[model samples]
Target: MSPESLRGWVKRDRIDRGEGGPGELTSAEREELTRLRRQNAEQRKTIEILKKAAAFFARDSDR
Candidate 1:
């Protein structure tokens, strides 16, 4: 089975066992996740900007 499938099964099994049923993340954990997500978004935006700059530079070089 794919890793995604395995992760889904594990999540399902936890819910079935009633062990906090996937458990709500702690405030700290939630904040950490949010911070990480924001960082990831920022990184992606930076990468897109860099890619555009590179493409522009490459076109200029070809001229």
Candidate 2:
């Protein structure tokens, strides 16, 4: 699965556990997780845009 999907799963698991994952995260670890989540979101958005662009080019080339 995609990193984004894994991130979503982890987030849900953390929520269900009342905080953190299998092992509780320290403040520093939590900050890092937050940063990583933000980066993951940006990467997912970029991938989506790239996919659309690729599709558009492919369709155009078929003309």
Candidate 3:
């Protein structure tokens, strides 16, 4: 099975065992994930700004 499929099976098995299951992210893991998500949001905002700037320059050239 593919890695994705394997991961899914593992998650399902964990849930079946009545463990924390998919909610098992530790304090450190959760903090890191939150930081990464925030960083990704910032990167997305930067990309959006760059796209708008590029479009504005392109429109100016077409004038």
Candidate 4:
């Protein structure tokens, strides 16, 4: 495909034709995405802590 066509294809495939995919994010949307990502990271950390605690207790009980 030509460069122009390839760019169009990439935009369509990766960003869904600028319909709010990776290549397109407004300032407000970017902030929201950052906040959501932080929330997700915090949640994952909490889950890991809980899992470790559970494993520790389970192991102690097995002895």
Candidate 5:
């Protein structure tokens, strides 16, 4: 592997093993963060859709 890529992998491994430094995220934390971010985005999209549907129905009722 390239030296830079190897270095990055080693760094991540160290972080995952809790040997890198303080305040560094472990693999589990990173995965959870990714999952939460995806879920948040999905929830935001659903909220937007619901809001638009509510507005459309309200407008239709006035017609």
Candidate 6:
């Protein structure tokens, strides 16, 4: 691996082990945050689709 990449991994490992500093996220926290962000994006898309469907039905019923 490149030196920079290896250095980053070592830094992250230190942070995960609580040896680096305070307020740094552990690996599990990072994974959970990524998962939550993906889920939030999916929910937003679903809400948009539902809103469009509702508007379509509303206009159709008025005809």
- Give candidate 1 misplaced runs (Cα > 4 Å): 1-20
Q: Arrange candidates by TM-score, highest first: which order?
A: 6, 5, 1, 2, 3, 4
Put down candidate 2 lDDT per residue, 1-63, tens digits, no spaces. 999999988876766567865676655667899999999999999999999999999999999
Candidate 3 weakest lDDT stretch, 10 residues: 14-23
In the range 20-57, model 5's lDDT, one tens digit per residue, is 78888999998999999999999999999999999999
Regions more than 4 Å wrong, model 2: 1-22
Question: Scored by Cα lDDT, where does model 2 land?
Answer: 0.85
Candidate 1 lDDT score relative to the true structure: 0.80
RMSD of each: 9.6, 13.1, 9.2, 7.2, 2.0, 2.1
lDDT of 3: 0.82
lDDT score for candidate 4 against the true structure: 0.80
Instruction: Quantify all predictions' global Cα lDDT against the true fold.
Output: 0.80, 0.85, 0.82, 0.80, 0.95, 0.94
Which 10-residue window in model 4 sums to the lowest lDDT? 14-23
lDDT of 2 at 3: 100
Question: Which candidate achieves the best TM-score against the true structure?
Answer: 6
lDDT per residue (tens digit) for residues 1-63 in model 6: 899999999999998888877778999988999999999999999999999999999999999
Residue pairs of candidate 1 with colliding backbone atoms: none
RMSD of 5: 2.0
RMSD of 4: 7.2
Alpha carbon deviation, residue 51, candidate 1 (Å): 0.5
Residue ranges of candidate 4 with Cα displaced over 4 Å? 1-22
Residue 61, candidate 4: alpha-carbon lDDT: 100
lDDT of 1 by residue, 1-63 (tens): 899999977765655556443565544566899999999999999999999999999999998
The reply for model 3, stretches above 4 Å from the true place, is 1-22
What TM-score would each prediction reach against the true structure? 0.64, 0.63, 0.61, 0.59, 0.73, 0.76
lDDT order of candidates, top first: 5, 6, 2, 3, 4, 1
**Among all windows of ten consecutive residues in candidate 1, which has the lowest summed lDDT?**
19-28
